[model samples]
Target: MAKIVVALGGNALGKSPEEQLELVKSTSKSLVALIQKGHEVVISHGNGPQVGSINLGLNFAADHEQGPSFPFAECGAMSQAYIGYHLQQSLQNELHDLGIDKPVVTLVTQTLVDKEDEAFANPTKPIGLFYDKETADKVSEEKNYTFVEDSGRGYRRVVPSPQPIEIIEQTSIETLINAGNLVISGGGGGIPVYKDNNGDLHGVDAVIDKDKSSALLAANLKSEQLIILTAVDYIYINFGKDNQEVLTEVAVDEMKKYIDEDQFAKGSMLPKVEASLQFIENNPEGKVIITSLEKLDDALEGKVGTVIKK
Candidate 1:
């Protein structure tokens, strides 16, 4: 049995609460399979859409005098609880059905980020509900927000995506895992927090890439493997094109070259590959698999997916 940190993709989790529950029901089966195979699983997941929806609803309510105002960081915190509850419920149901005695727990994890990180100067991550140009401008004016037209879908508020340096709740996570519990931590890349001069932690108005945080969590736990379960079956060069080619096994140096060539999309696969590189660099003996949740079984058997290693 090996210690593995698995980062579940946000897209795979579904966009709405109702859909998320249904999707996670199926997701729980795959995860329990890993447990059946004797892997110690530490689960992490992205909350981009969930957090954005929470923030947007909060803002809308506040604007309409229906609810009190809340900060984006608090919205991130709410999202962690919201998503975690669903996952915990679904995982528990599946485990009970299989007569598995493992306890499933969701920790409201916090990740530390550098306040002086260059990412703060450039806000590239988009969030919240999309709006028409006029409405976007109006909301931007009222709320003093930054909006960018997202791939012609509509305008969306953008936020800084800082890198995660450490997982604050790692000790607790380790304890849970060592006690034979399946733990879910590092939600929404850990509510993006920073330490003040007084060494007090405060939430930052930013998003930390979940993949990066998952890698950090894996490194912190000294996990033997990092499995990123995404929508893609395999990482491919020139993805969605006629010249596309799947990468079955990638060495650190080779992946770095591809990254330097800008072969991956900045908003998509790039972060996953970069995170894979980071985890491999930190834990040279460990390996990372990038594959869809549906193909997780095959991927574990080395029949499908891209595997990154030292």
Candidate 2:
């Protein structure tokens, strides 16, 4: 049996409570298939929209009712627990229906970051909602939040996006996986944080890319493959134009060339590609499967998605 780390993209869950649960019902079918095939799977997911919405609501409530604003780490923890709950419940039910008895649980995970990481000095990751220029300026002054114009889609509050250095609970995660338990942890990049000189852990106000963190976990776990599910079934060149072309398989050397050409969007595809590179570099015999959720099985079968290898 193969050990696989499946890094789910944003659709692992949805934005709303009810909608997210419903979506998981559909996703669970595919996940169950992987388990039935005897693959030891660990799950990590993205929380860009969900965490942003939670942070926005917390700020709005605090603004009107005098309640304290939710801290960034708290928002991330919320996303992890709830999203994991939905996934755990859905997957467990599907397993039961398949006559497979296995326990699935969600663990609130933490990722260690350097306190002096340079990204903290300049926050550039867009989060929360987009707002008009005038409203953005007002929020910047009143709330003291950084706002950056995102293409033509108004402005959003950008936070420091730090690199995930370590998974604090990796041992527990590995133990669970080794026992054939499906573990879901590292939600929203494992709640970015740092340790002080006194050894006390403190949460930082930053977002870590989920795919990047997943790659780190995959490397540490020494998994044979890192499967990243996104919106597209395959990586593309000149995306959205008439000249667009799909990439079926890309060697490490060739991926560097495309990266230099700026083929991937920085806000999205670029990080995914970069993460894939890191995983392949560490595990030379391992490979990365980048594809959409619907085509996961095909990607595994080498019939679809872009395979990145060293």
Candidate 3:
């Protein structure tokens, strides 16, 4: 059996409960196919839109009502649990329907980050939604949040995006994987936190890229393959124009060259590509697959998806 780490995209689980439920049902259909093929899977996922909405709603409530504002990490934890719940329940039912008795568990993972990480010096990672310059400035002043112009598309709040240094629950995850269990963990990039000098853990007000975190977990677990699900069926060069080209299989060296040329957008496909390259570099024999969720089965069969190797 192949050990694969699948990273679910942010939009896969919508903000609303009804919408998320439907999306999970559709996505689990393909994911179950892999389990049926005797592959043990550990899934990681992004919670951008969901957590953004949660934080926004909380901030709004705190402003109008007498409610207290929740910290960003707490909001991220909320997203991880609910999103993991939807995925776990949906995948469990799908597995049972397929007569696969493998139990699925959800872990609220805490990924370790460096307190002195350079990313903390410059918070360029955008979170939540975009607002007009005036509104953004007002919110930044009122809430003491950081604001930056995102690609000249008005202004948005940017936060530190720390790199994952370690997975605090990695031992438990490894045990579950060894026991023949399917696990869903590291949601929202595992609630970015850091250890103090005394070895105490505390949450930070930053978000870690889920794709990057997935690569870190895959490497830690020594998974044979990493699958990153996104909106595109294939990774493209010269995206969004008549000169767009689809890539089949790429090596690490060639990918680095493209990255050097700035072929991918910073907030979108670039992080995913970099994450794939990191996984390929760390696991020399392992492969990374980038494709849409609908074509996962075909991708696994070598019929589709952009596969990157070392």
Model 3 Cα displacement at 154 (Å)? Answer: 8.8
Model 1, C-alpha of 28: deviation from truth (Å): 0.6
Question: What do the candidate models score in CA lDDT, each in turn?
Answer: 0.86, 0.86, 0.86
For all candidates, what are the clash counts? Answer: 0, 0, 0
lDDT of 3 by residue, 1-310 (tens): 8789999987545547898789889889888888877777889998876787788899789999858888878988998998999999999999899888888999999999998899888886666666899999899888898887654456767777788889899999999988877899999888988888899999988788899999999998888999998777899888867998999999999999999999987766888899998888899999999998777878988899899999
Q: Itemize residue pairs with steric clashes in candidate 1.
A: none
Give lDDT tens digits, candidate 1, residues 198-306: 9999988887888999999898888899999877898888776789899999899999999998888665588899999999889999999999877877888999999
Total clashes in model 2, counting residue pairs 3 or more apart in sequence or in different chains: 0
Report the Cα lDDT for candidate 3.
Answer: 0.86
Runs of candidate 3 with Cα error greater than 4 angstroms are: 129-157
The alpha-carbon root-mean-square deviation between model 1 and the true structure, to one decimal in Å, is 2.2
What TM-score do all the candidates reach, one by one? 0.92, 0.92, 0.91
What are the per-residue Cα lDDT tens digits for candidate 2 across 1-310? 7778898876435557898788777778888898889888899998776788889898899989868899889999998987888899999999999999899989899999887889899886667666899999998999798888764457878888888999999999988887878899899888998999898899988888889999999999989989998777999988878999999988998989999999876666888999999998889999999998778778778899999989
Model 1 misplaced stretches (Cα beyond 4 Å):
129-156
Which pairs of residues collide in candidate 2? none
- Candidate 1: global Cα-lDDT? 0.86
